[model samples]
Target: MIRTLPLLLAVLASPALAQGLTDLDEVDRQVSAFVGQPTPPVDRRLRLARCTAPLALDWYGNGRQAVQVRCPVPAGWTLYVAMPAAAAAAAAPPLVQRGDSVTIQVGGDGWAVSQPGEALEAGAAGAWIKVRGLVPKAPVLRGRVLRPGLVGVDLP
Candidate 1:
């Protein structure tokens, strides 16, 4: 019985056993609050990991076309929820212009790293645009426009 007890504990402590699938309804509510509008329900087919911490929500793609929902680490996952056409059409005008100096940030879990870069193209909020780090020999990268001069990149 003692041997079996250790085996049972191991199974219970496994990462998969530690987390459950995220609730779609909770995701919908959070997304709606982030966008300041009632967002469409999240697809039921998704099987995202349950977040032990509060999910991080952000704008994604050009013109508020989608919302990026992230379940931070220990259960890291990201899902993009598309907005209705009318909402996309109402997005604000371009905020980041080509050749502008910007901050490129790569974030995950509870940490983020940022560096200065130059925008290679103009973009509105949530738009994915090209940017090159100001550091010598840096490669061009694509990131989502978070604001006038802030771009965010997701970990691969």
Candidate 2:
């Protein structure tokens, strides 16, 4: 029989991968509300979807570059957007547990919740929807998904 050590080890040690690290999955879902997947880009334009989660509940890394920005909408083959909660604790300062609403910005300035199977466009990228309102700042001194997607991001 073939050595299954490597495969077994990977399986046993494998951590839960958040497919929709961004809000792409949620985008897909919300988009479905307005339009379906694989629809014309125009139809997918300007959709707004929101998510309110307790900081203690869910949070995940948005994978930042410089100012901990670039918190994109979920985009994955499986698992929808992994809330920043999963990544909150991993961040320098964990997100507030009270409540945070992450509104995914879609279709170039059109803010909406992301749906499953949808795509994240370069224009759709943003940071903390509730704050900052900056574009994606990456290669950060260090950080991960912190808050909602901002509208405009200024980096030094």
Candidate 3:
């Protein structure tokens, strides 16, 4: 039975490492309050390795000090975060955390990129694009990935 321990460990880590963030109920509440919208359930996957670029959210001012951003795969499921190559140049890479931090929640308006574009890579699964911040606001305590994906923001 001792030998089985290793196998069990691998299986557990696989989901949390690859699958992406999951079931962030507390984080959802915080985000809804922050955005002043009814928080909807959201669970999506982004193959971070494929993400040539990354997610960047800069926080300016007081309240919840949004230091850096990360999207570490909490479960094993080929986890990744991405943005258009050009977007990467425009914004910093998204932060990935080793452990779970429900503080970060992404919303539809939280980001702004050149244009909502996507590529399948060589033979990837989901639609993909480079992005700026999830919610480029300082007091923005949380964020969430909106269903149907990206929306454009007028560049200043």
Poorest 10 consecutive residues of model 3 by lDDT?
119-128
Clashing pairs in 1: 61-126
lDDT of 3: 0.32
Tens-digit lDDT track of model 3 for 48-110: 332222333232212122222333334322212233333332233223222222222233456
Off by over 4 Å in 2: 1-20, 35-156
> How accurate locally is residue 129 in candidate 1, as Cα lDDT from 0 to 100?
87
**TM-score, every prediction:** 0.47, 0.15, 0.20
TM-score of predicted structure 1? 0.47
Could you report the Cα RMSD, in angstroms, for every candidate shown? 14.2, 20.5, 19.7
Using TM-score as the yardstick, the better of models 1 and 3 is: 1
Write the residue-wise lDDT of candidate 2 on 1-156 in tens digits. Answer: 359888777766633222212343444444333222231122223223332331111222333111111223453122223323223223334332212323323332444433111112212122232232124541212111224332332233
Q: By lDDT, is 2 or 3 better?
A: 3
CA lDDT of each candidate? 0.85, 0.29, 0.32
Model 1 residue 41 CA deviation (Å) reads 0.9
